[model samples]
Target chain A: MSLIGLISFIGTIIIFLLSKKVYKKMNWIILSPLLICPLIIIAILLITHTSYSDYNSGATWLSKLLGPATVAFAVPIYKNFPLLKKHAKAIGLSLVTGSAVAIISSFLFAMWIGLSNDMVNSLVPRSITTPIAMDISEIIGGEPTMTAVFVIVTGLTGSIIGPLVIKYIRIRTSAAKGLLLGMGAHGCGTSKAFEIGELEGTYSSLAMIVAALISIVLSDTFFPVLQHYLVG
Target chain B: MYMKIIKIILQIIFLYGILLLGDGIARLVHLPIPGSIIGLVLLFTALQLHIVKLEWVDLGAGLLTGELLLFFVPSAVGVVQYDQILGVIGVKLVAVIVLSTIVVMACTGLVADSVQKRGAKKA
Candidate 1:
């Protein structure tokens, strides 16, 4: 087998093993690849001198699978239709508001910090999942790859701190917790929400779908105008 | 059991078709959103509009959701290559993630809670 293929196999096995162990331990932060994998890889690269291109040569195979994986998300959304229907209005309102805030706040903050337009556009989609965020970043003339990094970091942060914030604020409803986390943070937040309970997971799943939809709309509509203004 | 398998396979095909259609629309219009995401939105819209029955895709969608984490593996691995970027931007990245998440959660929570309470009051 090729070196890339060999690495892919090993990477899969390691991820599988770690995922199982982390799931069993119920350690949302550690169990999540969004948090653990990046930290581990960063540590490896920092200690060693491996180039990203070399790693990506192997990792791209896995990356290609992202599309199919995303297509598969339809399954979950289908399964939870009843729950979604029950909270449709609430979900809709929350998704629109949450998505707007996520992109707008990031943009405003990036601007305040005097980061370049590219950086602002990259950060605008930080709250969305990587693939979608990358597309948005590219459309807006930001570096898709950099946007991917911000997406991962955003996801990990959401997964880690999401639940704690819920508890701290005394938000007790599983539905509320899940919706907030998923809408604001995407997959990582959904994973953490799942750790709390099935109700939380269900709501998180619904939120994830809704958030994706809202972000898509925003990327197509609001972002283009923002991009034009920033670039011009 | 055979029927279930066939249904799952068919649903996958339909989902793929939706993704492609969305992608085509995006390309034609020069839209920023990818086809898959457009497909997701379309699917959700269809569901809301009752154009497609939820039962048609339930099983497959369930399986996908269960393993959504697996899909992120490849990109997560790329983090291995970004060590230097992580070092220089690590603090900023961390700040962004931490602050953004908190702000999102707090804001969403406030909105949802107040909305629910308002609905309750009207009820």
Candidate 2:
């Protein structure tokens, strides 16, 4: 392997090792690998002035694994089928309402602040996963790359702070909590849901999948109408 | 152990095939969403219909799901490449993210609570 590849490998190993110790001291709730990794990269970039391309070249192999990882979510959904069936109506309703509100609220907020159309488009799919968010960004004339960043930021913040929000509000059911986190926050929230319990994780994963689908369809149909009536 | 590895490899190939097929259909029909999302929806539908057994796909999917955050590293790394653009739009980006997150969380929480209460009433 090349030097950069070796460095990336070693870096990941180090993070994995540190994670164990960190996990012991902090609740998995507070210290997420998701939140830590980017900060590590940023710190490295700032200190070493290492080019992003060099780091990405080393990291791309791991990144490509995302496709298979996303596919892997199917396992939990399958395992949780019984619970899902029991709560089918509640899950379905939450997904629809949560997704609609997420899209509309984000769009309105973007408009309220008078962001450019491209910037607004980037903001449109902020709650969805990267792949879906990128597609929505392109269709709406936003920069896909920026949308990806916004998606990660949105996910990370949601995942990290989501539980606190839930606790403060005193929302109790596993299904309700998971669906809200998953729909509003995507992968990040799903991870947090997983940390809470298997049941929460399962619902959160299902919610993430459903929310992404709902957001894509809503954006396609509603964005144009929004543009005509609100933007124009 | 060897059998498990082989199974995972097969599952990956199967999922990729589904993604490609979905992409092709989307391209042909000019669908707004990407082929992969369509593939995911198709897969979910197939699972619900019992057309495809979940047993074979479960292990691979489970492994992948736990490590989902790692998948975003590439794109996140890509952000570092656009330091100038980010610097220019940084405030707007932060505003959009922070504001949207609060809105999404609040709205989802309200909707979920109402749905749960409705479900409880029926039960």
Residue B21 of model 2, lDDT score: 77
Query: What stretches of model 1 exceed 4 Å from their correct place?
Result: A1-3, A26-31, A38-55, A216-232, B1-25, B28-32, B41-60
**Tens-place lDDT digits, model 2, residues A1-232:** 6687668656754664475368657777656676666667667767887777677667777776665556556667776788798888787777887777776777888778777888888888888877888988888788888888788778877887788778877787888788878887888788778878888888988888888888778777877787778878
Taking chain B only, the TM-score of every model is: 0.77, 0.85
Model 1 residue A17 lDDT score: 58
Candidate 2, A13: how far from true, in Å? Answer: 5.4
Error of 2 at B87 (Å): 4.4
User: Can you write out model 1's per-residue Cα lDDT over A102-203, one digit (the tens) per residue?
Assistant: 877777666765676767777787787777777777766788888887777677668767878887887766667888988777876776676677677778
Question: Which of the numbered candidates is closest to the native, going by highest DockQ?
Answer: 2
Q: What value of lDDT does candidate 2 attain over all alpha carbons?
A: 0.75
Residue A32 shift from truth in candidate 1, angstroms:
3.4
Q: lDDT values of the candidates?
A: 0.70, 0.75
TM-score of each: 0.78, 0.86
